[model samples]
Target: MQALLQEAASRLHAIEDRLTVRTQIAAAVAAMSIALVSTLAAGAAIISYRHTAALIESSVAGIASSTSARLDRFMATRRQEMKLFTELEPMQRLWQGDPTELRSALEALQRNFDFTWIGFADLNGNVVASTGGLLQGKSVAARPWFKQGLENVVVGDVHEALLLASLLTQRANNEPYRFVDIALPVRDTSGKVIGVLGGHLDWTWASNLIADVQANDGNTDTRLSILSKGGMVLVGPKRETIRYGGDELADMLKVRDGTFRETVDGQQMLTAFHVGNGYRDYQGLNWIVTAS
Candidate 1:
């Protein structure tokens, strides 16, 4: 009887010892698991921080690029404005055999502006003085630009002008290269209107201007041109060749009053239009400037 009782106690003690060992093993595993989880979480946080920092740096770089581009445009515009005031102003004042003024204006308009030709037209649409080749002594009586100027009854303000055969100077190959005319009205000191002061605009220079303006901008395809309401090509004349007498032209006519943007032929175009009215010296002309 004593031996049986001792055997039963010994078995109970062994069972208790086995349970304590199992509990200790579970606790150790749980502690190790917590440490592993903590280490993984710290690694994830560090990675997230690095990603955020990289994004911030990229954003800052974009902003800096935008700022630099804007500054460049501002500088270019300022330079052009200065040239207009300092160089063009004096030339504009000279008239009637003031060869120096005419020469100065001509040089500035052609060489500096990259225009192919320069000329003056009377209120009656007579050619006064022409500088450069192939246009001297040419009669412009039948030209659309002259007729439009007569019809509109205003001059002097800059607007787009058109060209007709014999009105424009012939190119070196004798092929007529049409150009947009940037014309204003000429006036006497008494503000009496005399004629239209006009010159040719180089499309290449104009393209450069557009590229400069768009160096940092997106979402806008622009055109700078001169045209009649009837879809005549003046400046950037090639545009008319591609889109003659279509719904595209109809869309353009809708926004001739101010600077605006529209989609034509599945492309975005920003445009600014102005009709010529001579408040200074030029009077009585209907001309338009379109910048898209």
Candidate 2:
């Protein structure tokens, strides 16, 4: 009995230590599980954010592309129509010395196509026949369209109409007349270049197209802009002159279609851009379309 008691006492040291070790191991396992779950949650959140941003960027890019395509098609169709109209025998009869018939044809064209003005200019830049006869006998020698038309088919960018502004019907709010020029050299029966057919499209047509795009896009948060090759804002929601700097333009030209975060007029925004690629047989003006 004495030997047994001594053996039992030797083996009976601190049984609670095993319990403590077990508790520590259990706590460590719980901590590891929690930490793993936390890491996974953080990673998921990051991925979700990136995905959402990508989708938003893609949406805006689509808008910009669609708008650019529509504008290109419209311009292409008009230019193609003009190219065909010029080859018609009725138009070729203009040089037959009947100014009234020529003027009548110009008026019919303006009426059909919603042009602000249409005129025929001789090689010497004399306005021989016009839509309303307003610029008749006037010399358009200094006009860019007339000069460019002498060489090749031309479609000019938007600009304030200098000589035709006051002569045109004024808006109630007194906005100046703006125009986009379409001009091409006319050829005689023997394929000799005779004169130029110059037409001024109402800039309102472009503005209306923009309005329609905005309305159809169904995104109130999206802002759209039409920018010239020079980066000047040709049409936009705001009246301020918004122009992209050289650095921005260079980056945009590199991609031609993409999105970037930017600050415009003190507001932070994400902007998507698409460059214009003109339709068949028409050279694009390199206009940039933007949606933010």
Candidate 3:
């Protein structure tokens, strides 16, 4: 019995030592595991951040490219219509000093095209005829389109159409009407400039184009902008951070087309841009389209 009791006591001591050794081993293993987990978590976070950035850059680039292509197509169609109008027999007759015929031609153009105003101007910048009779005889000599028409087919900058707004018999809104003038020089058979033919495109059409692009995007946080060559904001969200002709546009002027990171309104943004390369057979106004 004494021998058995001594043997039992020895076994207990051995078991206790094993348990103590296991506790030490467990504590060491737990400490190592915590350190390993912490290191792995940090590495994962870095990878995730980089992946998200790459994704955003690629996505924005795709959107910008696609939107630019659509805009080019839209502008191409308008340019074709403009060219066709200039080649019409009635337009030639108007150039030959037929005011009544010119008015009829202008009326037909207004019915067929989406222009806010279609008009013909003499070399002296006097309105020979216009779709809206109110603008007849108005002097457009100081207008940008008139000056540009003397050189080449050009699209003018966006501006509030004060005169047109005043003449509107029915207005949908009190906000001033905005328009972009597209003009082409009318030349005779000898290639000498005879007159200027132009039309005003509603700025709302451009705004709607941008809005449609944004609506089709899955990202709710994304924003889009259309900027002039001089870095003026032509189209942007109705936010203070993005305003017409705002300074935020300065960052876009340096690059012709590419993806970049910029801080706008104190928030970091990834932006992609494409420069306008006029539609087929027409010189495109160098506009920048961006998606962020």
Candidate 4:
């Protein structure tokens, strides 16, 4: 009876040991399964994040491309209009030393094109005829546009309309008016450079152009600007910081045409640029058109 009892006790002990080993094995398998699942989840999350980032970048690039192209077309149209103005019969008559024809021609042009002012200057830089007759006898020899227009067609940088302000006795508001001058050399029938035909375009017209782009795209967040090659802001949003050419815009002067990522005014931006390529026979001003 004692031997039988010992055998029963030994069998019970062996069964318990086997049960403990099986439990340990099951626990190890479960731990490994959990670890594997966690690693897979992490990898999937990383992949999803990268995919989302790529999609966002692609969308931004598309918008930049479309906006840049639209702006380029707009600039091209303006250049064409200026070219056509240089070829007008009245303008040609002015080049033939008929200063009397200038007022009527300029008035017609202003009525048709909505220019702020259309002025013609003789070779001596004396204003012979003007739309408003304000600066008819004024000499523009000291102006940058006059010097530039002597050799080729030129588009002057934006500046305060000091002449216009001084000429007008009445005031619509205290706000200062700004204007951009576009000038082309007038040639006689013998191809002699005789005079210059120029016009002052209101700054508001440029602002409206940008506004139209934004309205068409329904994207108010995007920024559009026309910049000088020297990094000066020719036309931009109402924001004083951007309009004045902040430090962030410094690098843009070095880039002729391309896309880059930048931080502007504490906001991350993707910017694309298009350098002016002269349209047809017109030589472009080499300005930079930026979309961000």
Q: Give me the candidate number with maximum TM-score.
A: 2
lDDT of 2 by residue, 214-233 (tens): 88876657788998877888
**How accurate locally, in lDDT, is each candidate?**
0.51, 0.86, 0.78, 0.71
Query: Candidate 4, TM-score vs. the true structure?
Result: 0.73
Error of 2 at 114 (Å): 3.2
Q: What is the TM-score (0 to 1) of candidate 3?
A: 0.76
Which 10 successive residues of model 2 have the least lDDT summed? 237-246
Best by lDDT: 2
As a whole number from 0 to 100, the lDDT of residue 203 in candidate 3 is 80
lDDT of 3 by residue, 28-106 (tens): 9999999999999999999999998888888888888777777767777776787678876555656757777787787
Candidate ordering by TM-score (highest first)? 2, 3, 4, 1
**Where is model 4 more than 4 Å wrong at Cα?**
1-30, 61-69, 89-91, 97-101, 168-173, 215-220, 223-227, 233-251, 257-292
Better model by lDDT: candidate 1 vs candidate 3:
3
Candidate that beats the other on TM-score, 1 or 4, i.e. the better one: 4
Report the lDDT tens digits of candidate 1 across residue range 41-155. 9999999999986654444334333333333343344334323432344544665556445645566656654455666666777666656433445566676555554433321
Better of 3 and 4 by lDDT: 3
C-alpha displacement of 30 in model 1, angstroms? 15
